[model samples]
Target: MQRPQTVVFTDLDGTFLDHETYQPGPALEALEELLAVGVAVYFCSAKTRVEQQAIANEFRVDVGFVVENGAAIYATAGAATVFGMPYAQVREALHNAAAACGAAVRGYGDMDVAEVMEHTGLDERRAQYARQREFTESFVIESGEPYELSQAMGELGLRLQRGSRFWTAQGEHDKGMAVRHVTTQLGPNAESFGLGDFDNDLEMLTAVDTPMLVQQHDGTWRDLHVEDMVRLSGIGPVGWCSGAELVLRRHNAR
Candidate 1:
């Protein structure tokens, strides 16, 4: 039988990047190896296209990426095909939800660069890139229970994704949808591996042939069950490398 094509999907913030430094760290070498072997590595993250674009340039990679928690997918050098509600409509809905629920919600669209930097610890320039959102709005609820906020979002035909620090309001599309879409496009015989380290990655981590949960900076793992999924030891890029090497080895052996 022919060996299946190998494809890797990785989360950015706390999977491919160091949770604290935001550097690729050990995953850098692994990424180079993957690219050297012509294996496709696609970044899957809640980050904006601007942010992922810069990362793609830095890595010298052109493989398509899923951005904003799969709100959209941008093929290499192609126009973005969005699967979720547009940012303008989501923002408007959020405002209405906040007003109706009397919740003190602060979304990325509502904050200035300074505020974003303060809240996210990203430098001013990176914060500016993050603010270039197109399909999803990440916000924090300061005065309302998370359940209440989720209920409000549900009533508006939206959903809330609970991240480690914030909640994202978006349409029904998620990383799983994007992953499946891309992999199916590659071929029915392609093999997929997904790596992630947070709640936001739940759907993605479960939607792959090889799901990998990386250790967190705090030495914990996201509580999710995926049959036959691999749990890597190292955190962030360290775990990313370990998992990549393992999967690639298996692929090569086949």
Candidate 2:
């Protein structure tokens, strides 16, 4: 197989999609340009595999995806490189860890489909997709401090990561580990780029040669510090566009 010279990994929520609207309208042009030049685009995010595949289907461009906060990587061929514990295992461990830490948490497993729709602002169909978790669990911390819960989780070799809206429990993993896995497949010379807008994205950003942070909906950048990281001023898709433009220039595709 011929080697890819450039690869892009972007977070979905609050990075490539609007935090509230979940639209990628502004970034479409740049995204198309990247695709036109055969630049690989992968959505690396906390979204479920179904949600990620839906986005890829909508845009019709997905070399692969890192889903559930790096719980797994799904190639376009449908093969998955898994890094997370099974969903059932993670869910059970989470409750046990939370109980030990005296944390009151409400996970998706505890919610009905309707309640998941309400909390996530997803329609019934999308809500079902969200609940179709294969690995890890997303939950709201109802009454416990995250620090204590995190420590308790560590004892079981699990971890808790905070996304834009909820906390996730899974095997110790992060987007960076998945990013590295994809780039390695692309070969050592492939220049990887990543974009994100939250602390949850720090690991992913650090894993790329060109890391960029999009401004949040509140017009602020994440306090994510990484060497040679670029800060884009626009929120969500706008910032994604700017970053994509830079990638195009770097790849000499524009």
Candidate that would win on lDDT: 2
Regions of candidate 2 where Cα sits further than 4 Å from its true position: 1-4
lDDT of 2: 0.88
TM-score of each: 0.92, 0.92
- Give the clashing residue pairs of candidate 1, or none: none
Assess the local accuracy of residue 159 in candidate 1 as a C-alpha lDDT between 0 and 100. Answer: 87
Candidate-wise lDDT, in order: 0.86, 0.88
Stretches of candidate 1 exceeding 4 Å from the true structure: 1-3, 77-79
lDDT of 1 by residue, 20-139 (tens): 888897788888887777677889998898999988788676667899989898876586678989899998888788777878889999899999999988888889999999989989
Give candidate 1's error at residue 171 in angstroms.
0.9
Supply candidate 2's per-residue lDDT for 183: 91
